[model samples]
Target: MLTGQKRKFAIALMSGSTQAAAAIKAGYSEKSARSKGSQLAKDPDVIAYMHKTRGVEESANPEVTKQKVEPEKMPVVNTLTGDFDDPLDFLKSIMNDRSEETDVRKDAAKAMLPYVHAKKGEGGKKDAKLGAAKAAHSKFSGMAPPKLVVNNKG
Candidate 1:
């Protein structure tokens, strides 16, 4: 029943072409390809022929679809295994590394600077005040509770 451009259109559609592309390929006018392709796809004869061809293709025992299995967790490879004895050793390594960018090496150098040289006015009264403030905070480590009393009558 399906023999002409309709048949060609259905064949093209089954081959993974869009409705518009299939319509254009089956000798339909390019201007109306978009609309005509949609119309031809809905034709009863075209549907029947496509269904018959699909059944025949399946009968040939080909793998229609395969489910891909993925691993739950990927293996992680650790590069560093106790390479540096001290934390400063790691910082120094990063600072001296030529492969790293200039800014990155400079940041590592800046981080290590405080550890090497102590500032003149480092120890002050602020440290003792901070200790007293921390003790006061421990006196009230309990978190804020929900307000239960509702004062409606003013």
Candidate 2:
């Protein structure tokens, strides 16, 4: 019953993509994909097809029928100790303490150096055309402009 991008979206959803991601992969505009995907997922036909394809029973909540997986744990920093007030402080202590390994201390210092050093006019307005230039630079490490050439022969 599904056709075009709707079919693509349904297949993608059955393969484990989120509704929003499936919509985008189905050629929907990113700006409207979230809403469009949600709308499509609510269709009875789509839900039925998804259930049949996945061998899941039709239910009041098709969403709950899908497999359940645990989300990854995010790293947590404990700030209760009076040893360091913030992450920056911890890094600063490591950077300045000579007792730490030279490589570890150097890494800590490198991390802290950015806050201590400020570039000229860093917060000022940016040039709109700089985006393309930046992308070009990133494509090649140590990239440089080619030399201009002019020749006259008589």
Best by lDDT: 1
What value of lDDT does candidate 1 attain over all alpha carbons? 0.71
Q: How much lDDT does each candidate structure score?
A: 0.71, 0.70
Best by TM-score: 2
**Clash number for each model:** 0, 0
Question: Worst lDDT window (10 residues) for model 2?
Answer: 68-77
- Give the per-residue lDDT of model 2 (tens digit) for 25-47: 98999999999999998987677
lDDT at position 65, candidate 2: 75
After TM-score superposition, the amount by which residue 83's alpha carbon in candidate 1 deviates from its true location, in angstroms, is 80
Segments in model 1 whose C-alpha atoms lie over 4 Å from true places: 56-154
lDDT of 2 at 138: 61
